[model samples]
Target chain A: SVAEQLTPVLRESKFKESGRITPEEFVAAGDHLIFISPTWQWMTGDEAKIKSYLPRDKQFLVTKNVPCLRRCKQMEFTGVEKIVEDVEGEDGWVTHETDDMNLNECAEEMTLDSSKMDDIEPKNEDEDDDDQEALDMEEFDVDNVDPSVAIIKPTPIATTKDSETDSVIHTRTYDLHIVYNKYYQTPHLFLIGYDENRQVLNIDQMYEDVSQDNAKKTVTYEAHPHLGPSMLAVHPCKHSDLMKKFLQIAEEGGNELSVYSYLIIFLKFVQSVIPTVNYDFSQTIKTT
Target chain B: MSEKKVFQYVQFKSLVHHDFWHKLSDIKLDIEKLNESDKTIFGTFTNLNAKNCLLELDCTSFNSNFKTAKNNFYCKGTLKNLNTIESFKNFNRNELLKKEGENLLRIIENGSACKNPSELISFIVLTYADLKKYNFHYSFAFTASIEPLIYEVSPSQNITDEFSENDIENFSSSYHLLDQQQAAFFIATKHLDIILLQNALDVNQRDMNLKDHNLDSTYFCFSDPSEFPYAAWILRNFILLLVKLCPILHGKSIKILSVRRDEKSSLLLSKLFFIQLPNKIDLDPINMKWTGWERNDQGKLLPKLANMSNSMDPIKIAEHFS
Candidate 1:
């Protein structure tokens, strides 16, 4: 039933984007149901709007108008109080007697004013007074409570720093992009690193991460039309062999690494080369 | 330095599903039945166990024109020292096979079996023949483990005065010869792509005549008249060879013409090299018929042609050049 009421609002593009339903929107639907109910004459305009939102199949019996009020009073009070208590407990706002006191006070107010409310205008004013009283009570409670007592305690901060930095070996994270060079008919790895500031890392920064032998043997300074002039690419002649070795290492490590997502596995293998740098795809960068 | 003798053993791991030991016993029973009914097929079985079994075929005793006549094959092995099925659950079948193979190689190299042995342990060669044909042809499958005698060549014993870097590159590139034994292991384990590359290199050396080629391009067509089960091997090998030897052909645009293509073979080709099937063209080369088609920028092969003819027509191959 709640889903049925919310579906139209949820389908709205703006609501979908924001991923929320405002209280006013929820109340508006409730108002529509109240306006269509059989007890419209007994309700004020505001009450009618609220009651009209209730389902048409259920008959709304005004509590005082019921013939057997004496029998239903105890049952009604217990059920309503239980629901309110459960909701208050979940919200962590269970003041010792606030909800029970409010319910009794509202009931006393309703009984004292029942004989005075014959016309719609007076009934509307009485409903406004009740709402104002509830709002005032909430404000009074907030003002009276101590700030320290009212505030929820924050979670304890994690004591552990990046364990990698303290270890003998230092590690870094890099972004690996494996582009299929149609001309070479081979996969080419485009590696970039992140600085401490998380910007596109310089070639000089990456040089420190790689071994001196591998830096000389495999790394080549090449102008990538998209990545720019400083981009370092793995030498094409050794690309296939290097890939085979990377795959072999991955296989030995117990990763199935399918032919389709070999690029992800390639990035994983390159993690060993950089050791410290986390290797991830470019798409992940855009999302984060 | 002295020449050192190395001893190695090829270990087979048990198949987790479908009892391998039971299957071998069944085969042993079939061999006995064949020996009773057929005079041509003679087999001897020994050391049969849950972990080990030996099957020896005496083809020399039978009179035949088959190549098996010259080769007396011995396949005596056991599937022991294996990881349990629980451990296997974490690994892909290919990865497990490869790990097992490497482990077996390690055991052969340094295990107690190699220390102070009575006699030298040599590598065994296995030959499988298709007996359905009148004259059966045998294919050699090599195991990964090998026992080779190492020779000592001192640095001071330099035969050549000097050699260029290009000379060294060429020497090293051709030196290892792509270890057919390792290639065979890959094939037996269904490592299709590696086998494709190795077989392609082998086919390229045997089929292509590089002597007359000052030309920009050349085509090598392989055809076998017999119902070869591994006919697709040629096409796979050729495709890989093109990528390895002449990557520039990717830009030049190579086309594969096939008369009939099946989904499984097409999917395999697509997975190995992300090439999709192309639109059909009306150009029909003389003596060659095109059925199913897939064209790519790298290169293509007419898989159906391998099955259609005993040898590819040179004139038809020239049509691509034109």
Candidate 2:
């Protein structure tokens, strides 16, 4: 136990700063820093700024949900091929199995809230084709929205009796994110499961394959490992080893001096749920 | 060094709760019945101040983990002098095996012995308030007794063989006291005055239905006189004397300091947890430097350094307090 407590001191031999460091700050500071942010919101403006600010010599490690940083190039590791296909045979997700039904309905609710926007369209007469594509991406077509969007919906808490205290306790669910590493290949998406007390129950690899719709060119359905072959699949890239190592080091339980572990867990959970397209982090680095 | 006084000890004082108004009325009636010759002996009335006295309360919580054998009173010589595994194995292994093995086996089978799961956890609450002309100083301490139920499919028949009423009474009182001593050390070290101890068993019963208050109860001691010589007298007398000799140190304090084994002291953090009382009493309040003291081989402050010192009178150490 004492040896375990000394890990923060061991990790500090390589760094100048001491005490606790946040997940975002850690990713920005260290070389070979891995980013496992699953929330697409991280892909927008803030991440772009961080990408620009990162040192050129430093390697940017990404697991999932990476937006195209125009500056950095992806580093696709040799060996495995990246494929997007719908994995077959499982009844992906049922409405009953949905953790939160309200979250599942959020896209419809958002579209209803923005129905007024439809009336004010075409204000820019000189809009280019690229501008149209961007606007289309932002629009919420509830019917066409991915079923996986339901995963983010907030659920009402439920209470259960604790045999220990003989008291009814409302169990809280924790969001876990992980990046699975397999050495030379890209890191795979990992999901964490916890029992009632928030102790980690399981860690599993999540892979997603993609398939096309009637349009042929527009890839629609992706096969997720957990949900099987479905319209929404989570893809695992080959170069996710770096991200996995980062998570492993964080979870090894030495210095709880950072909240980066919690952040990484949350990120990987999101990645396992949502598939990002041909976004190879290693390739992004080489191009940069 | 100040001379330590051999103070007289008194015990079993009655904490009288009297209705003064009723007493005054009775005295007036007595005065009217007095004869003319007895007129000189007149009843008098005066306002009296209530005295705030030292109070001690004792409580016990049950931890199943601390359970010993039913008939075993004294610990084995081997268990008592245990240091290493080799020494432990050489001791009476049979006794240890019977108790430890049975407990472990019970857990494997699930706690079928007790119907109520709530009996596994319990709490004892005690409150002590000092009466004073001004604000009274209140202190509280709590000890938790954890008793894990050992479950076994085939439990010993001796367990189910209910003890006779007298045997139950004897074991409950004496055995409970023996069990409570470990918790008492924790409480004393914490310097907590008012304690609430809870056990896994919910023993709440209707007061009206109860006959003897002591039955099915842990001991409760309030306004205990015995503690004066043991605890309160030493603290009060030493503090008062220390203040009298050094008037400027009146605002200084002596607090209970708790140090865990592996705690580290740092510039940004202090390893001590200090709970300040109503006021602080400074004794040797000024930390002065001493020239003589020997460090042990382990670099620890030697316990007998002052006794082994060569100096006739040690100088005041560095005044870190003042």
Candidate 3:
């Protein structure tokens, strides 16, 4: 990363090669979201802790107190999730899960711990691949996250189950903060969780809300860069590669993705990690 | 043993975001330089929950005039930020604390603290922004009289008990902007009372809107930076102003709301505390025992140092991963 450090892709023109965004791109992407969505706001996390590089107000983006009502266990993914389990290991955009000889994961109707769901979930195969692999990415993230494993792409709203119909709807809230990842050169997302009574939740409790796919590998608990205290962070390691997928498509479609739409596409994919933290991701990516 | 009723007023703490130091460095290198002038800056202390009170300072705290977020329960307090490493190193910590305490006492005695309750809390931050090394050294102090008074803490109440989310927002954001008579202090209560009935939750709205017509207690709200059971130390002076001005509230309980929200709930996870007001009065400013100096984690009397190498170094800031 020395050369990557010395000559960081400081321009948006070279985004495809760098797979990183400059500070200016981060602000551009952030401002676009701010104007369109009230849910996403720019916060200067305590004045002292602000990264001098980013502008004061545009240091990070936060959509606060997003409601996450049900745990990942309650989510019922569609049947294709079983197919993903078969082809889970390698980077195989073309390798369709063949007819199974023997069953391993989803076929057994056993009551599995939700974290065990990772064994059945496919990995983030979005490494920086060549042209043909980039072509395979088109049908995946139109609304974002591979529709098959797109974290609980369930019925838009979870209908209350009957046995607990009158019981107090125990809901957890998460404060989602997105900060620039200078090394990965993409925007990183963090979650601060609160329990039913509005008290800060421990990491274990927060894990219950994160999708088992990401919970096992991608998400980590660490100190927030600006706001002190560790938060549940969705690692930005693969965000740029994932972002480049959108870039390749937009280039092929002859519509350049504006740096502003970075976060719009960002939240779309981040949904695949913590699918249920219902912050207002209500807008489509406006490419202008 | 016949027990005497003992009271403990909420203590305020400082939530000094690192941006304060960064701003101080910028000001020193660009504006102040070697002059080391006593710059007039300001900080805010909120009154949301008794245990969450804090006098907060950040990059904006250095500005002579600044406006906080509209609905955030932060009220303005004028403070003096003394600059330069030499001054910060040489000043008498005890004398500075006393001077700050006496300044607050003078405002209370002169009746200005009554006119603006926000003035009840004040401070002086002695700072040394070491630009070359990227280390910031500073000592912070908030003025509050060191006196034990009779008080009691009640359980935390949900904010919806007093008003709906909209009502709290309407009152807190607009309270400081008031201009008419009996405005600042009295405005908080009256403004909220009207909104409680106005923003009544629609029944078809949901089960969360099940709050009844509970007119239990009024709030003295401020954006609190601390968590529960430990309020910002700045509340001491505000409570003192209350005890000094309104004798009718003397020995009576006054409920204060922590206008701040915790990480858990975005819906103004504000906490309300019913505290028994002090029964006695002491107006002698000279004899007052003042206490408030930001402490080291080991509870020692020393200025804290923060190394900003990862934060301010050119290589670090330019290429460091999050």
Candidate 4:
């Protein structure tokens, strides 16, 4: 990309030095993202718009109908206001305040953020381990053990007994996509929302879910150059800058980052824009 | 601002066999000798889990007895071969298509389509054959005179959701009911009793029984030609016929079945919709301007030409021409 050649940070782009990614790195990172989160699938947008730089099937990534059950304003009732810095008149994302929480929300955010890595793995992998444990228990004649010797199968307490009736189920869903912008040389995030009946949500209606402060400044409706209709996009102009800050923080904490983990980190920071959308984007940036 | 929910209709395209041109040449040379007049032609199409609606025509389509010639699923239509290219170009297409719609209205009004159910779906074809050059200019219109029809598409999908795979299998039908294909727009009674619309005694009795059926059950359905998001073009005429059959059904919702098949697996991909026709049909001809003329490859509103000079015998044709 011209931007990759001209930009000062990308001209000397080492993982810790800059956030900008090359086209080849983006495709490799995309494969890693799809492996960790199966919900994120590859799509070759429009046939005419397929990029020669990328493979046919790996044009972009999409996770459809990620449920956004509450308005951002509703979440602000409990969430701490973390102000996102203004970027040069650009497009980008907003974040969701924690929706489902325990009595305390600050602690809930920390637990939820840290726990997501383990929560989003394919269940089939764990199921086999569980089956092997059961077989070992049978060989040990565990079923014949006395009540005192046996491990008690304690039942989990309900989060709410009569909660569903009171809370209104919002039928709004968002289709999230990760598109590679050659100019910005970054994976630009785009979102289009729909109501209950699958009718597309207009700009004004879609704004209801976006964090009120960022929606006007960072978010803008841009038609996907190669895919479906126009969608609310977070300006990619500031993405590299934000990534540099994240890498600086990681470096200060004595940790190094891999290019394969770029999209996961990208999604984690992007949560600051579309915070309400419940897509399975990684909660915490991981390093290996 | 909220975007309006625009419903798209599934459409049919023409499939002309090579022999159909040969038959037209024979008729032009001997039978039609510059006498430009309309003639009846049968178009056969099968909706057996099909994604595209193919309105097919062959040499046998020119036969007068082709309607009852054992090929069951067919659409009744008219063919007009203009003598000159200028005449074909200058011809008032709106007038011809409106006339066809007027004929359909007359049949619906006279209670003929109700009894026979075969005249419900119809089409018209126009062509200008340059016999000496062996090139052809042709166009088609499957007209549905939607004059006073105000259709309301329901946001609620209760009827469509309830109408299941078993119901679709039972509504197993062909193009022409007169050919003995089991067709009903299948009904889902309050008690879940599925009945074929054809087997029902009369419109009055069905209306009487379904007077309050708007509460629990869906009434009136037809095999749709569209694999589009909404109902197809043929359903427009079918709905008009239903409104004519039972006038009480005005302002009432009618269920539709758009059955399609998977190209690879051949599995049925049928969808149901409940559309409400609010206004009563005006006995007068539809005065509304229509625009369903098939477009070119680039989606422009222009006529296409097929030059067959390459496929002809050069020496014999050159001698004959000279």
Candidate 5:
């Protein structure tokens, strides 16, 4: 299974380590394969080498900051560009944003309700050694428990100049937005789930509102503040299935699957959920 | 946003060589000391733009003239005693000659190897001519120091000719010259832009590299690799700015990893690779080589991390998009 997950990355690279395979063995391993870098240093490479191997439409979910050269004609690859160097604290911020629901509800629904949906659980968490050990040793049941409720803190809400409701939490049909201070030290995602009366609902209450005895699914994402919220939304018509799977995973505390490495994870997740989400280079301008 | 500074210098040698004594005018300078601000650190009154450039002048008179020449042309009273800038610095005579000598050798090596090296010969010749003017005062000068052949710009006397076998023979017979080397760190009043690199992906060709990744954000610095200690300081400030701006990106969600590559071998050392992945607590783990985490002598985690030392729970953090 690890090998399967690693196939994609390996397919995109020509291994140079002694124990690693030669180019021929890699070719035989073949296309559209999944791969995982054992550590972040693997991403560091000369520009020509990285350009030659990385796929045009594939995913590159780097969890670390390492220099890489992309877009080399000598490498026989195209559409490779160093979009950005993600220096964790120096460059930018990627904050997780939650809805009214909590982690327990998410985990329970993901595992217990998997029979109802045909989506694959996010594999990122599976690579975590500690999580694998935890899953192996502990069996948590989410049916009887309720997530915790906290004291409601009121804060000013930012809105457009034309809008009238200034400090109130607006109840929309689809999503909930929580106000986080700019100086907040943690990137934790927070959301205030509310009822029709604009009252905040705690975790157990949110679970009951969804009211599916069987597993329900949903897709959750951390808001990449720089990209705006539109990138967080599921494709049109593709939300139903994704929502079902996402909800199930979240109900079971499946936070691991939803955490992302780079923007590519979201793109891959998007393409996987909605096949119509184009990964075509024809639509992408060659900036390099 | 602090006030920026610009560096400007006047070449006294230029004015003296150009026969522009009458044209010389007073210049004022508002030069300040490094730390002390209250007392007038250094000021000048008289200008020497018209005076026959005195090769040697007392520190006080030179300081006064410096102030008159240019309000900003004053040094820290260090260079007033000597006509040449090299006289101000307390460098060992041998060391100065050695460094400058090495510089001359580097020039020769570069000139011999590079194409269109006419400028190299011109620079050397100009420097030699300047030193020749002071030859009478320094009797210890060696015969090898200023060989006639070294000064010979043959035929039309232009020093721009490509090196021939005969030129090599002439150079072997030519003597060497001594000059002081330049300083290591030269801080001028030039404005510089610093770009912060985040992911280290191929960015040389991208207009939207850092700016695209994070909406157009203003960065305080982009350090040059040549500036070592200063570069490190700049990097530290850049990190401090990010922490002040967005502290959430400090911990577990993102990790900062660095590896030093051997310039000659290209070998990557594993232990040299430092990674600061977010632990349970949101703060980044400090794993600097000499100093590990900021902890007490008890070998315990620092006070800030004591509560969350074992908090790195294996909570599923990423989603698998099928």
Candidate 6:
């Protein structure tokens, strides 16, 4: 009887038509699970009242006054090859020749007659070509070159053109499983993200969400035994702390909020890591 | 005594290093002096061997006629000789303590001995005597293993019901919990809240009626076990946090429950004993009940407790508290 009264507020989202969604569905909807409770309902058994508790904006969820990169757009290297070529030729030879000439001129000024005996060799074009070929061969040395090193080309940084474009953030999709950690007697979030190609996403990009000191303390390298050592994972240690903070904020509104409202608030806080993905915790799939 | 005194039950086990026996002997001498000064108190020491010793101190003579004092002391030779110890042959000697010993043995077998065995052993023995003198039921002993572990004396039924296969699986999977010593410490600290609650109930008796009972002024006495430093630190902080979180326990007098500086470890240990007025009012916002759901399968909807006809029935309240 209590389960019937508390289900609408504790497990299922108020916005969904189906009234229930599995954890897999929630992950598929691009939302991460911050917490789950089969019992311990803190809200009244009313749908409309629960819906009203959803956060209107993200201000309360995110950190304030921290200088963080709001969005990261990989700069397109449209003209990087031409730029690299220009840098190699102009930066290497021109700067070198000019510095040598300037030094020689200064030396001549100091000892005018003594330095004037040998005029600089009239611009040797043939020697310059030979020198360029020799440099090319050295740069392309197969025995000493690391092929993996060549793939990591540095991208040029560019400022955003306009406010709209600047605010457009890039985000990866993360699947969150809120497990009841019976050992700790607390709820824990197990998260794994993916790139556009469905490749596992590394957590190095999400370090900005946690303070530097906390980043060190919270992130632990774990190799799932069943999944094999290759299935290495970066786990955040303080899920209970995050859950407590979320509940505290929800309770601050004078009434206990539904799990949907809690989920929305959780997503807002995690937006610093996965900035632009539209998270829908209520998504349901039709069985064919 | 105006109120019946409850003796806090604690068990301490450390390595049987050479210096531990000598330090324990020294403590036996000191305890003898303390007993001579107070005729009502009596101390007895039994040297099982060079590595094993037992000290039993009784203060029942000093206590009022209605109260009872029970304490036990056990010591064994090096952890390597644990199988040879006669007391351990009795399978019924606190299963939780046995599990703790197994955990300690695993750690020691893995070659993780204490960095400073002599100091740790001395601290444990002194702390035991100090806590015993204060009417706290404390037990001290040694195992052959160098690795130290702590266990809360819990009801066997509760442990079986609460800890399932899922808990064991989760424990084995986690890197931190995989370490036997760390796992022992973690599990011990994690279960402390429930243990403390049970201890409170046992000490105060089963009577639930507290309409006009005094709500202020509560006291806690903590004895630090020197060997498991991490467990000691975590337990103290967890107790403080429990007080802060439990609405019924807020704004009561809190103190560092300890005796003598030399007897204390930077890491505090022992049973948490609280004294205060009975809380008749249902101050807890959340009430926990078994939903009859299977351990492996969490049901689609979380179950809730059914409304009772008489919410304030004393029987119901007592059952809930138990």
| CA deviation > 4 Å runs, candidate 4 | A1-288, B1-6, B67-72, B148-160, B163-215, B261-267, B279-283, B286-292, B310-322
Query: Per-residue CA lDDT of candidate 2, range B1-322, in tens?
Result: 1332222212111111111112212333464322211111111100011011111110000111222211111111100212222332233322332333333224212432122221211111111111111111111111110111011112112211323445434432432343322222111111112222222111232122112222212121111112121221112212222232233323322332111110111111101212112234322312211111111112221111001011111221111111
How many angstroms is residue A23 displaced in model 6 relative to the true structure, after the best TM-score fit? 13
lDDT for each candidate structure: 0.25, 0.21, 0.55, 0.57, 0.20, 0.25
Off by over 4 Å in 6: A1-173, A201-214, A224-237, A258-278, A281-288, B1-322
| lDDT tens per residue, model 4, B1-322 | 1342333354565655444665677778888888888989877654443333556665556766443212225667889999987777667776787688778877766656665565667787788887777766666777764333444366524333765656544443322232433331344454335455444435545465445556336544555444445555666666666666666667666665554433221225556565666555564454443334443323333444444332233543344224
**Stretches of model 3 off by over 4 angstroms after superposition:** A1-265, A268-288, B1-15, B44-56, B71-89, B106-117, B153-223, B257-272, B313-322
TM-score of 1: 0.18
**Model 1 shows how many backbone clashes?**
16
lDDT per residue (tens digit) for residues A1-288 in model 1: 243344332322222222122233323422332233211111111111122333221211110010111111222233232111221134211111123354344433433343322221110112223322232212212212211111112222111122333211111234343333323324445554432212233444455545333453455544332222234455444334444554455557765433334333334334333332322222211100
Docking class of 1: incorrect
lDDT of 6 by residue, B160-211 (tens): 2333455433422351212222211211223222112222322122234121
Model 1 regions lying over 4 Å from their true place: A1-173, A199-201, A242-258, A280-288, B1-322
- Candidate 2 shows a clash count of 56
**Order of quality (lDDT):** 4, 3, 1, 6, 2, 5
RMSD of each: 37.8, 35.4, 17.2, 25.4, 32.2, 32.5
DockQ of each: 0.00, 0.01, 0.04, 0.01, 0.00, 0.01
Model 5 CA deviation exceeding 4 Å by range: A1-288, B1-322
i-RMS, each model, one decimal: 43.9, 41.0, 23.4, 32.0, 33.6, 34.4
Q: Per-prediction TM-score, please?
A: 0.18, 0.19, 0.51, 0.46, 0.17, 0.19
Where is model 5 chain B poorest over a 10-residue stretch in terms of lDDT?
Answer: B136-145
Q: What is residue A251's positional error in candidate 2, in angstroms?
A: 35
Give native contacts recovered, as a fraction, per prediction.
0.00, 0.00, 0.02, 0.00, 0.00, 0.00
Candidate 5 CAPRI assessment class: incorrect
Residues A1-288, candidate 6, lDDT per residue (tens digit)? 233234433333322322233332333222222222111111111111122222211001111011222112211111011111222143211001112244234323323322221221111122223322322212212212211111111121222223322311222334333332222222233344433222233344433333332343433333221111111122333333454554554457555544344344434444333322223323221111
